[model samples]
Target: MNAAATTHHHTSCLRCGRKLTSTKSVATGYGPTCTRKVKAAAKAEVVAQYKPHQVAKAEELIEQGGLIPLRGQIYLAVSSDGSQTYKTHRAACSCPAGIKGLHPCKHRIAAHILSLAA
Candidate 1:
């Protein structure tokens, strides 16, 4: 059997436990409205967890395609200077700020955001 045919889908929305009638909803395990609300809440949580500047820089890096995935959970992020790159991971980054453990650097934040989206 095909993978899609073998897969088991939920009959209720995963978020609200509402009955799911549509094929797409069942497959995704969330209703359309619940999907939007869940996404918004996740975005809000990310924003609240990080500094505004760090979030902004991470968004910029994503928009610019400046983060390059390397091995597992590792990425190369372009430095603010645009001339250098730093090794970035969800837990650690090679940037100066990260090295000092002051706070999560933009590179590390960007890697984390990308992983969430993926």
Candidate 2:
């Protein structure tokens, strides 16, 4: 038996239970139409929806040394392991949480705050 065949990949869409046909749909568990809908909805969500509490958390982490401000408008927020560096800009970040779904992530908010203070 093939390893991929036994990997328990999605056979149907989780949202509507539609039978998955294409390989990409099977892998994502959502067909192109539904995927487009989801992406549209997500893109419509404004960055401000990230909430003030989440911004506070980002600030707290910065205070705790998880984020370090570098030269110019750039800042580096270290991951939990303190090994990987995530570059944060005034309105964006290199982190997945910053780019995925919504454009501005918590790291971006923190960077914005720092920018305003400066």
**Whole-model Cα lDDT of every candidate shown, in order:** 0.69, 0.58
- Residue 37, model 2, lDDT: 55
Error of 2 at 51 (Å): 1.3
TM of each candidate vs. truth: 0.61, 0.51
TM-score of 1: 0.61
- In order of listing, the candidates' clash counts read 0, 0
Tens-digit per-residue lDDT, 1-118, candidate 1? 3322233466876445699998877766667786556345437666888988888877666544466667776977767656667799979998889899888887887777766654
Residue 50 lDDT, candidate 1, scale 0-100: 91
Residue 98, candidate 2: alpha-carbon lDDT: 71
